[model samples]
Target: MTDTGREEVVREEVARAEEELRAAAALLTAGIPRVAVTRAYFAVFHMARAVLYAAGYEPRTHEGVLHLLSLHFVKPGKLAVAHGRVLARLHKYRGEADYGDSFVIDEPAAAEDLVAARDLCERLRALLPDESNRRE
Candidate 1:
């Protein structure tokens, strides 16, 4: 795809991810632990991409989320390392919330992650003005 096409795709995906995040927050707020954790996870995923786009890298494929973060955001020394922790936790939580049959989500865990993701979003927005998600 051309540069412009790729940018559009990134924008669309970012929006989709943001919607999922909002849904996740709502689920959490409503005492829906399972669904809330799921939403918190995707919120981080999209948050990663929002940073990617602001850095002039648009992720279009499924691999693009980690791929772009690994590229630009990862090379900033300690910040990259910190993001790695976020990536690991989010990725595992994504799989756990989706596939693990006996997975039991707790309110504390859900609340903590939701707060972390919301804070992360604020930090990302500070860094990337292109982010369009609601400023939770």
Candidate 2:
């Protein structure tokens, strides 16, 4: 992809990230904790993809995104390791919320995931040059 194409894709990913966050909050407000947890994890996942795109990476899976986030951002000190932990935790919770037959994420756990999602999104926004700083 050309530079413009890559930039456009990254922009789309950032928008999707924000949209997922909004959806997560709405699900939480509607008392759908399990779905909210999934959305929260997606929000952070999309943000991680956006960052990876900016760094010229094309992650093909959830685990790939998490691994790349740690390799390129956390390990290199581009982003704090705590943010990577948040991604990993959210990923785990999301799996439980999505695939575990008897698992249900409580409202408190979903809320915590939402916060982590928002924080990770904010960190990515600050790191990406094309992302708006309107929320800052």
Candidate 3:
């Protein structure tokens, strides 16, 4: 695909990430904390994909996404390493919430995940090409 096509995909992913974050918030409000954590992790994961797409890389797996983000953005000083840490933490919590039989996701934990996901998406959004530029 052309760079233009890639940018469009990135934009779409970013939009999806935003929508996922909103869904996470809704789930949290509805008192489904565990599911909220999973949704929040996906929001950040989509944001990571957008970043990778803008960088001309499309990772095929969750680990690939995280690895690319660390190599391209965090290590290169484009994004702070703390963002990577937040992503890692979210990923970890999401796995526990989803797969662990006894995992407990309380209100505060879900709220923190939501906030972290939102911040990560915003940071990645700034890194993507402007919509006007990508449209052309």
Candidate 4:
């Protein structure tokens, strides 16, 4: 693709990520703990994907984002560490939520996960400048 195509993809990802962030925030406030935790994963995924998109890289799945972050060579920070651990929990939770009988994630656990996820999202947001002046 051309330079124009890359820029467009980045813009699209930024828009989608910001929307996900807003949805995550709403879910957090509305007491939908499970949905909030899941959307928080999406929020962080999109936020990280936006950065990769701008750098001319293909994006990954939500779980892939977490896996990549877990690698020590990439963006070593507290957020990344938290993202890795939370991602492991999310992977298990997703599997249980889909296929396990009598398995569930409680509100307290979801609430705790949401906080970690939100913190990771915030760290990603801080890494990028606002949309209006995002010329990188």
* RMSD (Å) per prediction: 3.3, 1.9, 2.4, 3.9
TM-score of each: 0.73, 0.93, 0.91, 0.66
> Candidate 3: which stretches are off by over 4 Å?
132-136
lDDT of 1 by residue, 37-117 (tens): 777767777767766765667587546776667666666642446655666676777788788888778888888877776
Clashes of each: 0, 0, 0, 0
C-alpha lDDT (0 to 100) for residue 15 of candidate 4: 67
Model 3, C-alpha of 16: deviation from truth (Å): 1.0
- Candidate 3 vs candidate 4, lDDT winner: 3
48-98: candidate 3 lDDT, tens digit per residue:
898788878989998899899999999999889999998998898888887
Candidate 2 Cα RMSD after full superposition onto the native fold (Å): 1.9
lDDT by residue for model 2 (30-131), tens: 999999988989988988888888878999999999999899899999999898899999899888877888877789877888988898899987887644
> For model 4, where is the 10-residue window of minimal lDDT?
127-136
Residue 12 lDDT in candidate 2: 82
Top lDDT model: 2
For model 3 the local lDDT of residue 117 reads: 85
Residues 42-128, model 4: lDDT tens digits: 655666665555545564566655555555315566345555566567656655655677565567777677676667655655655
